[model samples]
Target: MAKRQPRDTLPTHIAQWRDQVRRDYGIEDAPGLILLEQAALALHRAEQARELLAKDGLVTRDRFDQPKPHPAAVIARDAEASFRAALRDLQLDVEPARPVGRPPGV
Candidate 1:
């Protein structure tokens, strides 16, 4: 019989995303790890809110029978912004490899 691998403590998507980010960015410090976690959670929240918005609608009728943007739209926007901010804070949103020195003829 094959030995069973231990289950991941984190949810599947979270673990997969975190591991991929870590591998892709070579994140090793505590602060980077924390920021990655924050970014992941924010992204998850944004996706969930987006899904709710899709299921319901982009607009809804208020008590006065006036149509307004769905509340989930705001939530999704905020969460996605938070995720982007976290990535910026972590310096993970930029190009992977940048040239180190000035041009030879400049």
Candidate 2:
């Protein structure tokens, strides 16, 4: 018989991501939960991108044509961007992604 890999465990990145929700955010509320959900989604997306990119950038192909711009890459990138935007919007003076420009009137 051959040894089989363990299937009762999550991937490394997925484990870390799930662990993040265990942090104490002082007050437990819907907003906090929402943040965690958003973070998880972002992490998932980034992981997808990493996996796709690691595959020699070939992604997928068919007998007729090959997809350009990398479909997975686009999805992952968009998910990451959406996550960042959502996180920024949920800002309660926490890690705000500052815009590099003059504030309205220069």
Across 1-106, the per-residue lDDT of candidate 1 in tens digits comes to: 9999884255678769888999999999999998988888888888888899989989999999999999999999999889889999988754477678996788
Task: Give me the runs in candidate 2 sitting further than 4 Å from their true place.
Answer: 1-24, 56-67, 92-106
lDDT over C-alpha atoms for residue 62 of model 1: 97
The pairs that clash in candidate 1 are none
Look at candidate 2 and give me any clashing residue pairs: none
Worst 10 residues of 2 by lDDT: 18-27
Score candidate 2 by lDDT. 0.64
Give lDDT: candidate 1, residue 82. 94
Candidate number of the best TM-score? 1
What would the C-alpha RMSD of candidate 1 be, to one decimal place? 8.5
lDDT of 2 by residue, 1-106 (tens): 9999764344677657545543544425677666656666676777777787777484566556865556777877887887677556555344657898888877
